[model samples]
Target: MEYILFQKDDFTEKNYIARHEEGSKDDYDITIKGRATISHGGRELTIVNVSVEDVGLYGCRISYFEEHQNQYYHKASQKVFLDVKVPPPEWRSAPILRRYNQVTDTIYDGDIVNLTCRVPGGNPLSQLTWSGCPNGSQTDLSSSTEAVVQLQFVASSSHHGSVCTCTALQKYASPQERSSNVTLLIAHPPTLDIMASPALPWFATGGNATVNATLNCTATGGYPPATLSWVCKENSTQNGTEGPSLLSVFPYVGVDDDKMVCVCEARNSYTAVKGRVFKTIQLDAEYHPQLELTALPGNMIKEHDSVRLMCSGHGNPSNITYRWEHGEWSMAGSNQTILNLNRTDTGNYSCTGASNSSRYGQLITVQYLPITVNYLDVQIAILETNLTEGDNVTLECQTEGVPSLYDFKDWNFQSYLMNDTQLLNGTRGKILHMENINYMESGTYTCVVNNTALVRHGSKLLPILHSPKLHPYRQASQQVVAPVNGNVTLSLYIVANPEPKPADFVWTKVKPDNASRNVSELASSAGLVSNLTIGNVRESDYGEYCCEVANGIGEKLKVCFNVSAQGPPLAPTGLHEIPGRTTAISTQVQWVSAFSGGLTQVFVVEYKDEAGEIWETSASDINDTGEGKNVTHKIDNLTPATAYNIRVKAKNSYNGGSYSVYSDVISIAMKGILFYNLLNENLSL
Candidate 1:
């Protein structure tokens, strides 16, 4: 028989064998069968039932027997080991205990607290429980397997000296447990009492004395905690909160000490316990004696002046006395004191007050005085009534004052004066004098009078006058008037005493006929001379002119001439000639005088022969245009052998005025030089 151990369904085939000697073969018939077994330290281990203690080594073995020998041989097989493994179980420690939080020094009535127990290092389990004996009674609690647990509604004061436990359970180890003892301090929340220092008396004056006070309070024990607040009893004013069992408040002064109380309150939020305490203090009131001094006409006393003084003292019990002292004077009165002062009495003044039986007295002082001026008046006058171009003027100043006096003087025209003398006339007066006066002396002059306490000022100046004149007449050259036919301006040379003076100018025209015509008159403060215009000029207006200047002092005149006309021939318009016998000879001439005039009479045409000799025709009467706009003239019987230069002029009969402009010259070319000889020979034959 043979056997084999294997896991479930591990073996697939089985074989038989016999033991034999080396190199020799002996055949024998043998049967083999496979057997298996599995074991473990605990119950049958399977995947579904795996655990930490079921893990180990596992093995399988095979065995058989030989039958060729007559004697049967027994052989044992090697041992097989089996191992099983399991996973560990989950574990955790219990929660840790926190320090106890106290609410107040004293706990009363309904108070609650939390007690906790914690454990560590455990697998698969822990439980917490609370046990206590308070007020002769025990608290019962059930065992729990939770990591943390809370106890609620613990309003009993009898829960003092309670024990709380935390237990941990492990699969193969002893169960662990942690325990703590809690002492429930049973007390009211806390009672606070506030006390003010220097307690008040029952009866006192209303507002005479100041009251000083301090406040204090205390808090007792409780579970969660308690706080203290100090409040004023009369006004319900909260002062402050304190944490310690005792609190002190800073000292304070009050206007009146009546109806004053301090309240101390304690509160615990964790429990419904509160406590409060209050105290009343009394204070005595008294009126302090006061001394006051008043001078006549108010606080300000004028310098070097006199004043009447009064003193007053006030207190309670109608036993007040007053004493007044100013400089060397002193006096006493039951309720008032009076004093009279002078300049020597200008010193520190004091007043004292006393009660009938008191040892001390109150005092006040007067230290300031008003300001005053003994005299404040100023007078000013010029040193001289008559002033010249380079003469000095002086001003005198005066003022009045007492012991302390001053003098100040200044002049405005100091630049023009050679010697400016400033002198002190008296204790409160001055004198200012200018050494010279000139053209620059025309300004405001001021003199100032001053003292240590006041000032005065005055001013005066001298008036000056002179006459202005214009110079004698000087001739001006003739002028070529502008062709545009506007006013003819002529300037004159003249002089006046005051370089420039207000003057009037008269402009006149002197015609060729030696007659003068006043054209216009102009007035100007500036000495410039100008003439009024003859708007449009004609041949009649071409003549000599004069400008005259005058002032109240004198008058002067200068002469010049204007040669102008409105329109003349721009060029020679009729510049042709007439035919002649045996000679191509003609006259060359120009037209003039586009406008008829008052003295217009004769026209003169001048020319130059081809040999360049100047020649003139006798003055000829020109017929006025039928429309009376212009004049025209003609000349004849000229030799054809000559070329000519020609210009025209117009004249006026009234002034013998001549045209300022000449007509454009015209030049003629002869047909041939022999034509003039032929004309002369033909005429002779």
Candidate 2:
């Protein structure tokens, strides 16, 4: 028998695997190749250390080929195919567990990872599996390459950046496996926070304008450290090194907006475009209080009308207060005030609104005329008191003022009937009783009442219908004194039949300079009375003023008044005495000129010692140093160590009214250091 190796029924001349015939054997050299073997049994051929070049179809054939056929046919052959493959370069390092999650080269919590591992082509298809997955976590295959194992895992934070590994196992003469691991590098967008570093107050009250307002922005929690940036309204930019950035600014107070808005951006480089966040906040800006004024009831801020003022100031810490001041009067209310309107209410009113640290104020002047009748007519007139033949109808007049004269010395009241030319008695009370009434008794009646203490007066009129014989009585005004350039009134009080015409009022003035002026043009007529008003009274006006009043049918009545100066030129007020500046042995005195009698003034300062010796020196005789309306004098070389009483009075060269009543006595204690020192030296010697 012969054993031969054949290749696909064709014989090769040089290649030999194994051959044996009848106890004689030949083998492929195993020492050089190390993977091929041939047994001397001549039955088998094997090759080790497989390579690509060893793949082919082989056949074992017998050359006898059924010898009976003897036709030289090739022997019957059976064939088999041999394959050799290595483990595909160790699976290419398990495919580098990356290429997802922004290429961070890692897996993170809540990440869905698809990891592929290749076992490579080997003697049999390799096996693939995974490990390090959380307990009860199901694994699924996303897809795979030929000879590669792929697995997808849904991760959770509970995975906690643990190892995730995919392994490949090759089925060879010895099972070999390889694994690749991925440690997660979690990425997150920055959690951003922005705030005013220190809150700003609502106003700049008590604080300088250079106060720094800072805004802070921060970011944290990302794969790479986050950076912060800021943009402010003042065209400014700020940057931060790591997570937090700060921008500082100064507010312009009232010149800036009431609020400040700032924005900050935070992002991480590793997270690319998706890892960004922003935050914003508004802060209160300091400013001054803004004041507003409001009035109610109308613009007619007049006497006897209800008027109110409201002042408001707007600011932070909203508890603001308001004060309304008018000269000597003031009201305190947070926002509003109402004051009673009086004759004295016409003046500048200041409204001030204040906060804890700031204040705003404004002033307004209120002016209005009093609501009183300037005409000579009374407030009430009841006409048509009918009195005919023998019908006595008593006419009464009602007035507002309580009578302070007429019957009682201090009770002032009067009633009269004006007829033809004389004043007829109207029963002397508020009521007029007419007996045996006739057309001749009908006339106009006047009632006047007054209260001098309160400076109030009231009067009324009643017209009796008929043609009565009228009688008139004359009453002259009393003497009056007024300030220079002030007003004075004199009248011829009367009762007459017909209303006194303007021609009936005659007034004249004789000046102290012996000049005369007719003043009837300044006269006004009202019923039975006529008045002359002297305006712009001058020093020359201090003299006799006379008036002659007559109805067309009555006897003329005449009266006169004596006008005087406000006071003697030396009348002094606000008087005070002090020790002389140079020496306490004498005294210095000062006084304000209350009235200078419309002329230049000199003061008389009198001092009396306890010994009944009196000394007098005029302001003109001493120091005449003072501003207008003030008189100051110093008396030197007086008796020392003596108690003295000092008083002051005023006099004028232009008018020598007696010197005014003396000022209150001011007792002075004299200090004579020179006298005391001399006495001490004498005693010592």
Candidate 3:
């Protein structure tokens, strides 16, 4: 029998052939390692201990004897192929861990880290996994000879001093696992803080003694310990104390040392790779008080002018009080910072702070304008107000002021109801001479004095002295008429060198029987005029009256007057409208008063719409203008945006008077046009 073998890789033809003769003398080796044997009378083939190299095709051929023709022929059976598979061996060592894309074991925060784990020399690739690296993610990469696992992550302080591990396993192994690990070192910056001991406001003593303050700095949670140092204005750096807590001592702090700052700087390898960290604490050091004094509006003050003196004080632990003094007297109860200065606030002024007794002072000068000197019976250089024609006169001005240096500009003369004109062609002295002064020159003359600080105008009336003269309102032949049960004022004008006092006038009532008596409580005087009021006049009072006046410098004078029966007051005149005081709702009307006919008089203002015929009357309260002065009345509750005619009438208890002439028409617009024009003018200005 012959056996043929073919490799399983290709099945085209036989790769090996062997012949086994029946009972042949030589033994034939048919299979590898002699593990192949033919059994059951050469009908079957079996292989033990199968290996990969035994993979091939096997077949057998048998030759039969031919009786008729003695030739050898072979018959072949079907061919069979063999194949082998081997399981991987168990792991002997742990997986090897290596860092990829990195050269050092330490890394800064936020740096990307890559680590790979590999298992080499495995028939089939083993399964790889990661452990211990909770912050990183893993990826599996396997090859025919090795199993690999790579882990990538961003490093941070939380991952500092952490172990990263990679594990390897096999499927055919009996629950066996091997792991390798590496420790990660993450570097980070530290947190810094600074503080001051014994609080702030470090005080200093008088000599070389002082209250010292300590400064401390601390750095927490860093890979390497941080170094600390102090920096201040006086020094660049100072030596620090031991341990994680750093300290430096500051000695002899003074008021001048206030606002100085101490800086604490912390640095490490991590900070070197990143940035520097530091903290600062400003010093609130203090000492005794120092004061400065100043004044507003200068040290020199004019009379009646205002000034303020300020005392500025500085100190530490500051509770300072100020005191003021002038000359040898202390300003009691004046413990304030500012003192308002006045005329009495002259002489040396000193100030001191309560914390320190040192005083600061300044000299204050007071200046004043010139004042006129007065002599008896002659005020402002004039002795009388009555003058005659062609009288030679001499005027003088005398004044006194401080600082001595002064200038008397000119002498000016102003006539009654006229502008002032300079006399003596702008003279520069206090005395002014005039030849033959007349009644036409009976006006005011002014002397102007100036000291470059202020100007003064001293005036004098030049009317010469004379005897008293009477100028009654009514003519001597005309009689004053008054009504029964009415009041009246007997008024007259007079001129004299000296004004008449209330006691200088006397009045008497003379009846038709020629009886004379002094009327009690009947005389009153104002300025150069006198009045005698009579109430409830009767037929007994309608007779004659005499008024006498006298002054020490003038001869006494007497006048005769008569009183008759009742007659109405005269009508008012000069009906004028005050446009500025008039508004849409009201109008201010003023009129010149006429005679009262020797009795009390009241006014009545009447108005009417210019376009209409209806008239309205308003009775005014009895305001007797004793000297026939202007009387003012207001008309309210009038319609706006309408033209109106207004007039005033004077009435007594009698019934003989009529209304006065009408005023020019006026219109009332919204807020009046004069208000708008005045407001616009002010705005433009």
Candidate 4:
């Protein structure tokens, strides 16, 4: 018998097992190693310990002999059909893992990992499966007896040290399974994290002397361990430029770490081959910001000039602030501020730049540049000093010259023909102190200042022994005609050789009520024209105003004028007369008081009978008390049963003050026959 297998695809034939019942004794390869096998069936073919060569279409042939007519002949039977198919895949060997097409058990994270498993031979075509792989993997079984399984996956941190298994089994056969496992080379990038070694209390306060920021970095993923690196950067420079640089190698924080940004980085690669993964984080080590101040127009600000200032510095935190400080004023901005420089702004200025952990300051001075005048400005406000012989006068002599050198400036006073007296001689500044000044010291005061090889002088005329003249508010009379509840002015002028300085003018107002106020300044000047402004005057403010001026030479010279705040007084009302005994003519009449004209006065009461008498009897009541009071008096010998009416008038010290005007009155009065029937009966008895 001969067993032959036919390739299903090509119908090619191959002899598998052969046996002879009767044949020559030269065939010796049968049943070698017991691998070539057969089972009990004349036509059935079975193989044990199968290999890839065993699977195909199989057939069995048998030969027989028969004797006929005394002669023996040989006959051959037809080939019987037998087919062999592959079973489910069974692992013949171990699985292989590859990274980047290289055989490696260590696959790094972010790498595509490849896995392959193959079972060479099985009947009925084995199905292949992967144990530790994504679902829906494909099995390759195109060949009748060989099964191939391949899988591809991306390596991740979770895949580290995990096992990848390829399994094969024949479902129809005894549930015997074969499997191969490969420890996955899950190479992953380094696990990266950083922290301040010594925790910090506060990260921002400009510069904190206590802050020493050291960043610790760690890497934890991938097969072979990962390495750490660091980069250093300065937020900015003194010129406000970003300084970005890296360190030569990984190292601990150095001395220059202050105001330096240390970036921690972690690196790793698949197969531990070359650098691939890079993770970085920045750490800030705070310190005081270096502060500098620079002014526009170069620091020496002239009066009425506008100056701008800028502050620049560097710190660990890139976010910085700029503030300008002069005295108690501070402004916040990016790095610049502006100021309108004036005489009051001459002082030391400080600019502060602040950062997270520290602050820095810069100082500079601002003042008026030296004024360049060809000659000294001997400015005497008024030629009439508005002073007297005994007045202590301060003669001001101002000029433009180098005050630091005495040769630049000098002061002298001289009369018409008297010899010049050196008053002030100083290099720093020039002024004259004329104590107990007399007429002899009155003339022209001169300031001599050297102007670059030229001796130039400025003169101011001075006067002595003059009094201040007074003038009311542009009115013919020396009285200020002030309106009620309105403002008024009592101005005065002086005709002295030198005008009085603002400090020399004094004024006092003696109110009609003698109510005085604290000394107040009401005088001002506009060149040679000087006057006092009286504001918000009322009728109660009506009184004499005395302006006194004395140059310490004679008694204080005083000028007096009058100002009034007068208006109409309210009308008096509620007037009535009380009746007495019918036999008696005595009666009492009373009425309310009206406007006092801002003064203590009296009320004159006049009444007459309705019989057309013009003026019957009139009486007077001294209104020595204040206004708003009732006045009553006794009238003797009054005839009863007579109709009468009374009227009143009020006056103030102000000339032509207010009196009752028609019906602009808020009052009432009662004058009628008094009820005296009982009194008349008693009188009759």
Candidate 5:
């Protein structure tokens, strides 16, 4: 038998060998790498049995022919061994339990929460269970060690001291548990209640009152505190801080009752809770008696006027009673007092205001008196006299009154006063006799009576007569005077009733119809008068003359006088030759003057011529003296001149009512001269 073991790079092998009798079949057994092996032929190797170790190296030997040819290598075999190992089973940590806690969690009632428990570091994980107050009030969980247990219901006062717990379970190690406790505390704030006294009761006069009240409040348990306050409803102020907790308010001394409200408020620090309470207090005010007085037309009343007085007052539930002095009077209602007075009622008066509770009164006074005036009467007089130029005149005034009259006293009449005097007498009845009655003391006068009530009321007009009338007389022709040249003087006499009286004398011309002309006034003594000279007298001065006398009071009287001129008649010059067939002719005649009254009369013209020497022609008369002045004439009915002499003569009544002088003879040629008569011709020249 032979056995071998060998080593390879990554394996080992074992071989076993045996030699048998040459003729018998050889048998071999071997094990390799966990298998068993066997062999039989000498020169050939075969696996008869195998084992696990016979896998790698092998050897075999056999002999049959050629025995002893070299006893070589009979058989060969191989063996191997195998080794195996298993790993230990896997390991892991179980779940851990987590506990959560809440310290000052502030929650209101009816709030839900979930508490968690976690288990870490466990193998194969673990399961979870919730414990503590189960009763279906907490949530359940499974399949996980980290468990969340939920408190589904709210926390309440009944839930106080309760806990929510979670537990974790694993296949290894100890069980884990976690817990949280909940405290259900309700935070309710306080409520306030208020009350008041005097409670709707009526208060009368002199009634005393007292008030009593209380404030009640309640608060629930909470972490922080609350506050309560009392206040007045009207002002909304905190009563305890601003003023006294209890207050008393009074009405005016005489007022009625009223109602008032008081309030209480409550508040908390942690919760928004506020509460209020209210109460009402009733109060009645008392009254005292008072008085008011009045008078009609209060002061400074007029004379003979009347007035009224009144007094009134009021008290608690009603007005007070009124009483008047100096009469039995009592009144009710708002009008409690009264009085009616005239001038006779001008005196002091008193009134009283009274009630069942109180009384008061007052006093007053009044007065009366007369009417007045202030003036006098005055008189003025004008003495009667001739009111001629340069005459002395006097005027006086006299006033009638007990006291002397004032300076403003006035005397009035138809005329005004000229001088200041108490007694007035003058001409024209405006004179006062001061022992002598003269011509200046005659006229109308008046005396005026005056006073505050009467003005310029009394009057008297008197007449004074101390004047004479004088007049002049005249006797002359009735025609308008013709133009003449000379100085002429007429004489007349003045007659008057009062001899040697101061008078106004005047001389004037008069016509036959008695109308005067050329008036001239002069101041003189009344009597017969002489010539009133007229220088350079003309034909126009040949009219009648008269004299007049006046004393400024009555109608004037007059006397007439005759005046004449003595002068020769002069031949008329500037006569143009008359033309044949002329209807009328006018010629101008002029002459020179001789005596003072020349040409103061009428004139006559006559003419005769040869071949027809005829008796003196019919008279052609011109009434006026040719006193060296020009005068106009119109001669009619004359034939053409045939040589003629014309004669003219002056005439006057002073010369025995005849011709006074003859003019010189004048010759005129009538041949070849046309004679035109004014009655048969147009004389427009």
Candidate 6:
């Protein structure tokens, strides 16, 4: 047998030292070297046969040249203890089992292992056998009085924690059999898998910007357990040690996260050689559909005209479907993208797509203004009746037509004479006002409305009966108030023997220059009463309005009123903390302004610590000049290491109106505290 004490290709020469007893001061005889053969540049020492005399410590000294100093010295040295066995008279001891290296009992899967069982001092060479270990080859290295068996096999995960037993049997001994056992510790890489909370088809519902989910990485079947970790695009890497799984929280998963890949990795002690195992998952998300309704061949639909309305939808899922509805009922059996116009189609049309989101289109009115005179006769309404001679009267004509009568025609008046109607010169507009109407003027009066493409007439009989005393009266002026971007209605009640004509109801606004501008175009009449609506009122709309009435029976009466602008301002928008302006004790907040509601408005800044429920107004009375302008305010006296929620609101000056709704809440943390906490966590890790 050969024993290599020390081997190094770089060494120049090697020396050997032997001692009969380990840890003894006596030096071994140099003559013993003559019986042993040393080869391979003195690296190996071989003896033909080994005996108990070789049981001692052997030391090796080697000399190697140092390139830096250019010198060779016997500086490197190593020593190993050796044991020798011989035949014994009778069996006395159990077998000892150990691996070839005798360094560690742990082995990795797929590794080759060699175990030896030796029994010393046994008569008739006690039989050495291996048990518990399967699929292993055994070799006999027996002497006259000793028994030895070597077992070799490949390690596997199944062999972990299993006991490999070596037994020595002597039929003549008092103790017939003795055994030694060693537990095998096998290491293997783990299998990895990733799981998600609220598992697939992630939907962003409730108009939320992002949907939150949790990802867990699990490792299974590894000795010494496995460490799990996660890697994501939007989140920092996280790890878990010797656990069933590692969790990663995704707080802001949106439609953009679709197909985003996230990785989970697992490793163990054996993973160094086998490499880490990982599993990946691509996010699948479903978001609300974005829809647009468009009309084909033009939106001005006419009766019996063909129309196509397309509902274009975009969303995460590619298989989105659509449905069309008109007014209260679905368009049954109709094309999903088009609807033919009918004479009765005069209401709203809407569209709905997958994701169950609905969108409304503009009001559709089917135009049916034909040139037939019956159309006018069926649609016209006469405003005045019961006329008498020598009495002033006002007549109005109401009709429906496409493009509006005001835009398509200038109302023409005609009178029936000699059993025929002729155009009455100097008579214009939808209303006819006659002064002191006499029997000579009594006849059938007609109101003519026409465009370049069509013409129609609406007429009524004005017969003289008997004369009666008449009086014209006007009501007092009233006060009206509204806010900017709001609507206001100016109403007037009139009483007279003959009611005022629709054209006689005039509205005018007094300007700051003391000049009057006719706003009569905004007026409409239902009977004896007239209403003038001012929509989306502006700053210039605040003033006095006057209504004048003339019936040829009394002096023209004038009614005047003042219109005042007042209301709360609109809510502040785009509230956020101004970056690079926040500190440990103060932070600057910014927002965009909205309408002032026709009154002077001021902004109020409010904030509160995350732990507190009550919000504290940090700054109030911040000056604002106009809408759509960015405004900023600084809040101070804040504590460090604290998180705060901030918001802004607009209030009317002099408490004229209510405060506007609060802006969106924003969160801000003290600058240094975040870095400090992160640094501490890293240090602790």
Q: What's each prediction's TM-score? A: 0.23, 0.38, 0.38, 0.38, 0.23, 0.33
The residue-by-residue lDDT of candidate 5 on 1-685, one tens digit each, is 3322223223322324433344454433423222322334233343334322233443433323444564434332343332221111111222223222334554333345444444432333434555664244555443422333344444443444456444444444332323333333433333333332333332333334222323332333333344545454455555332112334333322233333343444444334532332333333333444456665556333334444556665544244555555434333333322233233343445555544423212211111111111234555544545344234545565554322433334333342122433443232222333344433333244544443334443455434333333231232321223335665555444433243334356666665434333445322333444346666665555657766665444456666655544433334444333344233222223344333233345666666654455647434456544344444444445455345565555555554555545556555553343446767864322
- Give a tens-digit lDDT track for model 1, residues 606-658: 66675767677634455444222344344456666566666665544534344
lDDT tens readout by residue for model 4, 312-378: 6665555666666666766775344444545556566665555443333322222222212122233
lDDT of 3 by residue, 195-245 (tens): 777665455534532456787788776666677778886646975643477
TM-score between model 2 and native: 0.38
lDDT of the candidates, in the order given: 0.44, 0.54, 0.63, 0.51, 0.41, 0.65
Tens-digit lDDT track for model 6 on 65-184? 667888765544565666664444434557777663324555889998889898777445678778888577878877754677889899998887788888887775667787888888
**Candidates 2 and 5, the one with greater lDDT:** 2
Looking at model 4, residue 494 earns an lDDT score of 47
lDDT of candidate 1 at residue 371, scale 0 to 100: 23
TM-score of 1: 0.23
The collision pairs in model 6 are none
Candidate 2 structure lDDT = 0.54
The 10-residue segment of model 1 with minimum total lDDT is 28-37
Root-mean-square deviation (CA) per prediction = 26.9, 23.8, 17.0, 23.3, 29.9, 35.9
Candidate 3 has an lDDT of 0.63
Off by over 4 Å in 1: 1-184, 187-215, 220-247, 251-503, 510-513, 520-530, 535-540, 551-685
TM-score for candidate 6, residues paired by index:
0.33
lDDT of 2 by residue, 471-544 (tens): 33344325466678898777666544455576766777754545344566778877666777778876776788
